[model samples]
Target: MGSTMIEKILARSSGSDSVSAGDIVFARPHRILSHDNSAAILGIFEKLGGKKVWASDRIFIALDHAVPPPDEKKAKNHTMIREFVARQGIRHFYEGGTGICHQVLPEYGHVKPGVVIFGSDSHTTTHGAFGAAGIPIGRTETASVWALGETWLKVPESFRIELSGEAPRGVVAKDIILYIIGKVSADGATYKAVEFHGAGVENMDISGRMTICNMAAEMGAKAGMVPFDKVTEEWLSGAGVKEYDPLYPDDDALYEKKMEIDLAGITPQVARPHKVDNVVPVSELEETVIDVALLGTCTNGRLEDLRQAVEILDGRRIKSGVRLLVYPASRKEMQQADKEGLIGKLLQSGAQIAVPACGPCLGAYGGVLAPGENCISTANRNFKGRMGCREDTGVYLASPATVAASALEGRIVSPYI
Candidate 1:
């Protein structure tokens, strides 16, 4: 009888008392986000006869996908976006070097509990880690939001996923989510909202929660959320969020499906080349060679991730044949890592620390693999051609620890060893 978190958020956003799955409502989002693709959205907006955005203040723009511009065309796109931002008076614009849009927006406190956000990137669902609803929208839909200030969404059915036991040593949030996705398959939760809770989730920090939420997109989920608890409150408060009305689903809220996972026995997991759901335990794979080891992205590019990598690589160097690339998610994160000497440790370990951006993750630019080469990355997806070389090169997805461990051996290996 009670409403789920997604339902409650939708109800409030639409000025309704209650909403149910399948109910369509026009909701005004707390924020609308766009990144490198904003250039295309701008063109579409103008085509739709849009002169000014409905809410300039609530619109956020960032240049991240093609940082530094891989070519003259991308550079020109950034130029157009810059001109658009200036002319539209959009105050929340972040230029290249600021970081990936997903990481940049939340780090700046743009995401808050109980609010709804729509981002043009699929990974935009990463914001749900803050107990808010972050939905991914297409470019044209984003253009519509820019012109009309509102968009329609069908309240998705809810999936109640309760995590019961603590994760095993050396197993991080990425491993746990990968295990779940392997069980459910890629399309198992299509168009559903997954709400995470229980002892394990309660024990997770914001970074861990963010990792889980970030991968929910791989499960075909509309959104992934953790209830706003003390951890959420503490993170918000630390970010200078003084006021927010956190929302949670009632105990009796209806769920379309439910699952309980005990992480006590879970171990380090990996998603092999070509598909995120093609997952297996790190121990299952044969010792495979790696040409590149990437240590950052929106998924696992936080300070904690860098520190973990530092712990593993401090006294040693990555294999001579392997190229290790470390990219911090944001300028602030990069600065903090530098202040703590983590960056120096990585550099000393023979790792190349790139600027704060989404480099090499989408393979749009930076660190593209050569023919027959493969990379071990802390990124979310591992689909073929995702790393800019589909014909021969491949990508493997794992946690930061595993990435560091494999970098040392120049092969796929578990960090626990």
Candidate 2:
């Protein structure tokens, strides 16, 4: 039987024969990434009679969620995490001011193809963009891996998505993904692996791949992946990947479903409030006004995304009543944008720059939405009350282009025009 891409990678890592979907595999992870959300899991594990981590340095910890902690309790949690990381001897400790775990993992070479990565974060699916098997496990499972150095995985069925036609102007990978989420529903791809392929995917840049893969969890997917190619090789090479090999699914590999997407006439899309699956074209929601226009997150806070925003908002001031918040994904990204004058342009255009954390996205440390306020953001997830509002404040998920356009119009608008 021909092995799927995931099976091949896992088999190699586990030192086993060819494995198939539906089979259970026990494999050592290439990386185990966790953030403050699960850092407390370590303490819980200790309370549950597990003392030391099996391998200290294998764990990667990021203090992003409560970064620059919003209150005293959150600050104590950050302090506890620092003490835990120090006690565990974790070398990849990213203190406050570092980027989100998902964004920094790949950039720092902690995520690569042909390897298994387990994260305590649900969005760890973001690492699959590099052709790696990245899955989010619950706290107990994460702690067990920390103690045992390995974990069991039930192979997931595969879903193949092949894109052929070009995405229309102002449309982005986020739109295509949201469209898929709407079609597939929230749990449509549950316990399944999604593989992105075809010429349209190939035409997309690295950041676009990250954008698609980052939202795989929205479908209740086990993971989402793209085949490693020259682009992957180049990205890995630049990040000091010296002796890595790319892997792909065999021609005869099995998939439970296949979807062919033609983005030829697709317009910029938005995920309406309280549900990521509530997708609509920008033209359909032109009358919806917004109070906040936020541009940045682990999902769409890359350099290219910032550049796109700057290109659209270069000389135009943000519309009255619109408070545009610009946040770079990382300190490096902020510095680069400043050097390139994009930050200056944004500030001059009435955009308030927020610090580089998972701010405003997860409602942890920065920027909480109030009832009756409306925001158009590039961040992932639009669940009701997600941004710290009990009354279900409105949040429209969009790309940088759409966000910049909406900031300039104070309402949903098409950037293509």
Candidate 2 vs. true structure, TM-score: 0.97
Candidates' lDDT values, in order?
0.91, 0.84
Q: What is the lDDT of residue 221 in candidate 1?
A: 95
Candidate 2: pairs in clash: none
* Residue 44, candidate 2: C-alpha displacement in angstroms: 1.5
Poorly placed runs, candidate 1 (over 4 Å): none
Backbone atom clashes (below 3 Å) for every candidate = 0, 0
Choose the strongest candidate by TM-score. Answer: 1
* Residue-level lDDT for 335 in candidate 2: 85
Error of 2 at 151 (Å): 1.7
lDDT of 2 by residue, 1-417 (tens): 576777887787777877788889888888888887655787777877778888887888877777678788888888888888888787888877777888778777787788888989888888888989888898888888888889888877899998889887767888888888878888889998899999988888888898888898889988889999888888888878767776899898888999998888678888898888888887787589899888998888888898899888868999998899876787777888899988889898998987777888877646788888889999888988788885858999998998999899889887878
Give the per-residue lDDT digits (tens) of candidate 1, residues 274-370. 8899999999987789999999999999999998888888679899989999989999889999999998889989999988888999889889889
